[model samples]
Target: MKKTLRNTILGLTVTALFISGTLCGCGKKAPPIPASRLDFLEIEVAEQEKYIQEAEAKYLEERAKLEAANDSKGVRLLDTMNRERLRNEKQILKKQQKELEKLRQSEANKK
Candidate 1:
């Protein structure tokens, strides 16, 4: 009975340590991104910028058409959808930019 209790306590302690280490990330850092990956990220950012510009132009054109037709509802709906889409796209772009910056910084540190 005493041995069984000691074993149970040891097991609980080990389990707690494992859980804590996993939750705390084990003090590990991410692997560095290569220069090729950075170049790809730059290209991706450029493409995203171009896509955003095109989307804005298209939204304006559509808005103009709806206004000319005097369709207030269509205009409102289009505006809402465009706003949401732009918001999501911009968020993605911002996240990518941050990642790129982080990788670049890490690369610079290595140099």
Candidate 2:
């Protein structure tokens, strides 16, 4: 009976020491996730960049076509329309560029 009681006390002491050792290690460390990974905004910025590029390309092409055409009523009408279209495309490009900047700023703020 005395041997059994001594064995039980030893077992309990070892178990308590193991549990204390495990819990002691947990309090001193930081969390797993870093600050940068919590908020990601690159994908939206990339999409906005793509949209701005395409809009700029289209605006430049229409401006060139407007410049090359001979002056006539139809040509004048087309030129007017192309000019309007180019203006709209530029506005869209500007808007997309702004969105990209905003996304980048938001991402930077997260870090």
Candidate 3:
């Protein structure tokens, strides 16, 4: 009788938790950002794009100078460094873009 009672209590507790979880909703949507915040994000993304372009141009110019000097080792080192920098910058840009997109999506959903 004690074993049966324990099993019944466990089952009841599990069912109650399930019902509460379902009612509470697992994925709550975030509130939309304000228009000014959206604008700021847009500006940030644009600045990031510009920065990436400038970095690429600078890298190309430096690479050309190294090639002209015939410093193969220096050229290789520069290539490695520039590639890592660009990769990091691009990742940041991607993150900013994603945030902007999410904000836009939330704003649209709010309407």
Candidate 4:
């Protein structure tokens, strides 16, 4: 009987102390920080800076690929135009040669 009574009193005392400590806010909760004490802008700036850097990198890579494709297209166009020009020049030269030959034949007939 004495052992059980002593255990009961000890349990009650522990319960009372727990209740008092909880009401006193004796647990480890940090105090609320004032807005001026927080570095919210700094944290946001860092994240935005990271996002901007990634965006720039992506833009540069895409622009490089686009420019390379455009350069290839330009080269192919120039080649096609140059081939057309050469063909026209060849045709004009042949016509001029034929006219010269006709004049020579006429001069021989007159002699």
Candidate 4 on 30-88: residue-level lDDT in tens?
A: 43443531244434445555655665566556556757788767556655665585566
TM-score, prediction 1:
0.67
Candidate 2 on 7-48: residue-level lDDT in tens?
A: 999999867765656434655442233244222334444655
lDDT (10s digit) by residue, model 3, range 6-94: 99999998777665554335644333443687898998899899999998999999999999999899999999999999999999989
**Cα deviation of 39, candidate 3, in Å:** 0.9
Best-to-worst ranking by TM-score = 1, 3, 2, 4
lDDT values for all models: 0.88, 0.62, 0.86, 0.59
* Candidate 3 residue runs with Cα over 4 Å from true position: 1-35
By lDDT, the candidates rank as: 1, 3, 2, 4
lDDT of 2 at 101: 77
User: Which parts of model 1 are misplaced by more than 4 Å?
Assistant: 1-35
Compared with the true structure, the alpha-carbon lDDT of candidate 4 equals 0.59
* Number of the candidate with higher lDDT, 1 or 4: 1
Which residue pairs collide, candidate 3? none
lDDT of 1 at 33: 44
After superposition on all C-alphas, the RMSD of every candidate to the true structure, in Å, is 11.2, 19.6, 12.8, 37.6
Quote the positional error of residue 25 for candidate 1 in Å.
Answer: 47
Q: Give the runs in model 2 whose Cα sits over 4 Å from its true position.
A: 1-71
Residue 92, model 3, lDDT: 91
TM-score of each: 0.67, 0.39, 0.66, 0.34
